[model samples]
Target: MRSPFDLSFRLKIPLWGSLLIVVTTLAISTSMMVQAYNDVRSDLVSSASSLGGTLAQTLFPAMLHDDVWQATEIIRASLHGGRESNVLRPELVFVLDREQKVFISSQPQTLPLLADIRQRGEEYRRLVDWIATDAGLETRSLELAKFHRIYVATPIVDTGAYLGTLVTVHSKEALLARFYSVAWRGLGIGLVVLAILLPINWFWGRRTAVPMVQLTNSIVDMAQGRASHLLPQNYTHRDELGRLFEAYELMVEFLQDRARLEQGMIRAERLAAIGRLSAGIAHEINNPLGGMLVALNNFRRRNGQDERALATVSMIERGLHQIHEIVNAMLVEAKGKARDFAPQDVEDIHQLLAAETRKCQVTLQIDSNIERPVPLRATLVRQILMNLTLNAIQASDRSGEVRCTIHIAGDQLLLHTENGGKTIPPEVVDHLFEPFVGNRESGHGLGLWIVYQIVTQQKGQISAESRGGVTQFTVNLPLGDPA
Candidate 1:
C-alpha cells in the first residue's frame, strides 16, 4: 500500500531501477569522458611535437650549413601543413640560441617574443628553467594584447650536442570553444535518452503490480458470499505470478464448491434432528389413531346400516383413517431411507389418481410436457409426486383444486404444483421442506421431507413459495440422458 512517490528502497520500483541505471550510466560516461579528454590533449601535443621536429630538422641544420634559401622554403612549407592539420593550429614558431636570443622566427611581423633575451630577463629565465629542467617538452599559457596561446617548447639538439630550443604556439581559445560545444551536445543527448526511458519504466512497474492488486481485491470479495470473476488469463508467461493467479483461481472454485457442500450438510443435520423429534411424536400417537380407525370400520361392517347411517359411519371412519395415515407418514420420513433410481412416466401415474380426486369432488390438473424418455427412479418419483399432491389436497381441505405442471427446459426437467391453501408464514417458510414439520393438527411434516430427499438425491433442486393466499412448490431435476 505504499504510494509511488515515496521513493524509498522498499516503496518504489521505478525510482530505484531508474536511479541505478542513471547512476551507472553517468559513472561510466564520466570515466570515459575524462579518458577521452586526456587522449585528445595528448594526441594534439604529440602531433604538434611531430610537426615541430619536421620543421626544425629540415631548416635548422641546413641554415647552419649556409642554406638560407632552402631553410626559408622548408619553414614556409611546415607552417602551411600545420595550419591545414587542425582548426586550431600553431600561431608562432621561433628558435632560441644558447643565450635565449631569438635566432630565427616565423611571423616576424610582430616584435620578438623575448625582445632582449637578457633585458626581458626574468620571464625568459623561468621559461628557460622549465624547458631545460623538465624531462619532457613544456607547455604554458601566455596572453599578449587580446589573443591567448599555449606555448610549447622542446630542446633542439644536434648529434648529442645541445644546440638551443624549438618553440611552437597554439591558439587556446579555439580548442576550448570547440571542445565545450561537443561536450554539451553529448550531455544533451544523454539527458534526452534518460527522459525517454522514464515512461517505459513506469509502464513496466504498473503492469507488474496490477495482478497483485486484483488478487487482493478478489480475496476480499470471496471472504463475503459474493462470486468473483476469474482473473485475466495469461498463459504465455511461466513466471511465479502467473502460477499464483492460477492457484488463486483454483482455490476460489474449491471454496465455492466446499461452501455448497457445507450448506447441504447443515440442512441434513437440521432434518435429522427434526426426524428424531417427529418419530417420537408419531410413535406416541399412532396406536391410538389406528385403534380408532379399526373400531369405526368394525362398527360400520357389523351394523348393516341404511344409506344415512352408513354415510355418517363412513365419514367418521375416514376421518380416523386420515389420522393414522398422517402418523405413518411421519414414521416414514423419520426413517429417512435412500431411494433407488429408475425411469418413470409422470402422466401415466397421474391418470391412476384422477379417479380418486374426481370422487372427492376435486379437480386435478397434470402436465405431461416432460413425458419424453426421462431417466428417473419410478418408485421415488411416484412417491414424491404423490406425497406432494396429497399434501396439497389435504391443505386445500380435500375440496379445493390441485394443479400440477411439468416441463423440460434445456438440460433440466421442472415440475411445479400449486393448490388452494393459505399463504405460509415467514417463520414457517424455512422449515416447510423439513421432515415431520408440516401444518396439520395430525400432520408430521414428512411429505415435503421425503420429496426433498428424492429430488435432491437425483441432483435436482426444489423450492416452495406462498403468495396471494396460495402455496406452490417447484422441483427441478437435471436431465439424465445415459452418461
Candidate 2:
C-alpha cells in the first residue's frame, strides 16, 4: 500500500510466459502438420504416377495385338480395391487409344469403351482435356483436389509410335486418413510437451518473478520509511534481473542515508526554533525587568521612613535584580558570536581527539584541505567536528580506522566523519541525533544534540547512518547566513 505502482509479477510472468510458449508450440505444430499433409498428398500423386506407368507398360502388348480382354483384366487387377468400401485403392482405371475410345474399363457400364472419354464426368472432362492437349508420348497428371481424386495419364507406345493411354484414378481420401493420423500424433506430442514444459515454465516464471515481487515490497517499505532488509535469494548473476537486484540494494542504501539526513535536519530545525522562541521571550522579559527595578529603587528612596514598606521594596528590588540577571544570561547566550569557520578549527578538533585516539589505538585520518576562513560559525563547526570525531574514536575498535573529511562545495561546507565499528541497529540510528537518546550505554550521545542545534541554527542539515560495520555522519552547513 505504501507504493501505488506495485506490480503483480507473480501472476503476470507465468501467465504471459506460458501463453508465449503455448503459442509458439502451437505454431510449430501447425507448420509440421501442414507439412505432413503435403507429404501425404504428394505420396498419393507419386503412387498414381508409378501405378499408371506400370499399367501403361502392361497394356502396351494388349493394344499392339488388339487384345481388349487382357487390357480389361489388367485394368480390374491394377485397381487393388478391397471388398470393403473403406479400403484405400484406385477408384477407376481405363485403357484408352489415341482415338479417345476406351479399349478397356474397370467401370465398364458407366464408362463403356471410354464412352467418348470426355462425357464420363465433369471432373474427367477436365482430366481428358489436359491429357489430350499434351504431346501424346509424355506422361501427365491431373489433380481434382476438391473431389479428393487424382488422374495420372501415361502413354502406351511402341517404338515411339503413339498408342493407347493408361489412366489410373487415385483417391486422396486415403491421404486424408493418413494426415489425420499424423495430426493426432502431432497433437499428442504437443500435449505432452505442454504437460512437461508448462509446469517448468510456471515454476521458473514464478521463481524469476519472486525477486521482482520482493523488490516491489521492499520499495513499499522504503517509501514508508521502513528499512528493507531484502536480500535476493541466491541472486548473484550479472543478467538484467541480477543487475536490478544490485541496483535495488544501492538504492535502498541511498534512501536510508537521505532519510537519516532529513530526520536530522528536521530535529535540528525544531530545536533551533525552540531556541529562537526562548531567546525572544527572554528579550521581551528583560525590557520590562529593568523598568521595574528602576521604579523599585525610586520607591525605596521615597518611602525610606516606612520600615515595612522599605523592606517590601528591597525584597521586590532583589527579585527584579534576580530576574534581570536571568534575562541577561539568556540574552547573552542567544547572541552567539559570528566568527567565520577557519582551517585552524579543524586542526584544533584533531588535536583535541589525538589523545583519545591514542588511548584507543585507533587511527584517525583527517582530510581538511581548506585554507580560507569559511563563512560559517567557527565555534559551532568546531563543536560538531569535535563531537563527531570523539564519538567515532570511541566507537572504533583497537587499530580501527576513523576518517573525517571537511571541504567546501559551492554555497555549503561539507563534513563527513566515519568509523569502522559494529553496525548500529536501525532503531538506534533513527533517533541517533535526537536529544536524550543514548547510542552508547554510558552516554546520551556524541554531542549530536548540540551538532543538530548548530546545523539547525545555521539552517543546514545533518544525517547519520550505521551499517556494514561502518558508522558514518554527514553534515552540510551553509557558508553564509541568510539575511
Candidate 3:
C-alpha cells in the first residue's frame, strides 16, 4: 500500500477535474435557480398588486352605485390561468363596502354577496382586524402564507370619497407553483449545460493528463534503466506542462548520447589494448620464423644430393612459408593480396548484395560515381561497403529500398548507405562503431567495429544517422598511394 500521492497524475488529474466541473456546475445552477424563482416571485407579487389596483378602479363606481353585477363581472374577468401570463392569477378576489360586508366575489357560492366579511372565515376576520388597525386610503399587502393565501387590501375611492376596500386573497399554492415552474425551467437549462460541458471537460482533462502520465512513466522507466516510451509532444501548447515535456525529451537525448559516447571510449580503449598485444605477438612469431627460414635454406643447400631428404626438406620449407604468410597478414592488414579501389569493385559488391536483396524481396540500389580506379585499399574499403550495405538491407522492411552510393569527396572516397527502416535510438547510433555494442544473433557486432578501425587507420571519418524513418551510414577514406 502507498499514499495517494504515489498515484499517477494521469489518473488523479482527470478525477479531480471532473469533481471541479461538477461543483462549479452545481453552484452556477443553484444560483440561477434561486435568481429565476425570485424573478418569477417578484412578477407574481406585481401581478397581485396590479390585479388588486385594476379591480379596485373598476369596482369604484359599482361600490358607489351598489352595482353588484358590474363588480362580479370585473372580478371574474381578472381570473386567469398560468399560460395566460408569466405570473399566476389571483385565486380569490372580492369587494368590500364601507360596512365591511362582502359586496361581490368571484366565488359567489362559497362567499355570498352582502355578507359580513369578518364572519365568513377566520382568515377574513384576520384581514378585517388588519384593516381596522391601519386605516389608510391606498393599496396595502398582507402575506398570510400560513393560511395559504396573501391578502392585498386596496382602498376604493373617487375624488376623496371613502367608498370601500378591494381585498384580493392570492393562494400560496399558486405562488409556489409559479416559483416551482421557474426553478424547474432554470434547472432544465442548467442540466443541458452540464450535459454538453461535462463530456468536453472530461475529454479535455484526459487529453491534458495523458501527456503528463506518459512523461512521468518515461522518467520512471529511465530511472529503472529501461527504454522510455516516446511522449506525444504538443509543441503548439506553450503551457508549463508542455515546456516540462520538451525539457525532459531533450534531457533524455543528452543522457543517451553521453552514455553512448562513454561506452564508445571504453570499447576503443579495449580494442587498442588488444591491438597492441596482437602486434607484439605477431612480431615475436615473425623474428623466430625469419631465423628458421634462413637455417632451413642452408640445410637444403648442403643436402641437395640426398633426393628423399631434399624432398622432405622442400615440403617443410613450403609449410614454413605458409605460416610466414599467415603471420604477415596478422601483422599488417588482413588481405590475400593488396589492390587499388576500383569502380568494378562496387559492381562486385552489388552483385553479392543483389542475391541477398532478392531473397528478402527488397530493392537494392547501388550508385557509383567513379569513372576509374581510386588510390585506396580495395580489400578493406570493399569490406566497409559490403558490411554497411548488408546492415541497411537487414534494417529495411520487405520491399523497402537499400540505397548504396559511392563517390569521391574531395581527396577522400565516400561511401554512403541508406534504408527506410526502424529508427535507431541516438544512444545506439552513438557507439555503433564500437565492438560488441549491438551484439545479437544476427551479427557479432564486429562489422561496424572493423569498418571503424580501417577508416581510422586510413586517416578517414565514418558516421551514422537514423531519423525520419530513415537510417544511414557514411564512410569517408582518404585516397592513398599504391598499397
**lDDT (CA) for every model shown?**
0.67, 0.79, 0.79
Clashes of 2: 0
Better of 2 and 3 by TM-score: 2
TM-score of every prediction relative to native:
0.59, 0.60, 0.56
Report the lDDT tens digits of candidate 1 across residue range 438-466.
87876555778878866766778887788
Decoy 1 TM-score against native: 0.59
Q: Would you list the clashing residue pairs of candidate 3?
A: none
lDDT of 2: 0.79
Which residue pairs does candidate 2 place in steric collision?
none
Tell me the spans in candidate 1 whose CA falls farther than 4 Å from its real position.
1-36, 58-88, 91-112, 115-132, 135-152, 169-173, 184-205, 219-227, 231-240, 284-328, 333-345, 348-379, 386-432, 435-447, 453-483
Worst 10 residues of 1 by lDDT: 334-343
Candidate 3 lDDT for residue 67: 86
For candidate 2, what's the RMSD? 9.8
Residue-by-residue lDDT tens digits, candidate 2, 1-483: 544235487978888888898999899999999999878767766777777778888888888889888988888787655555432357788877887788888988878874787777887778778877876676677888777776778888868887878887777776677788899999999999999999999999988888878877877887787868676464677899888888888987898889868865676666666557657887889778878888777776773368887888788888888777655543323246778888888888888888999999999999987788987778778878888888888899889999999989888899999999899999877767555565777654426766776676677878888889999999998878622
Model 3: how far residue 321 lies from native, Å: 7.9
The number of the candidate with the highest TM-score is 2
lDDT of 1: 0.67
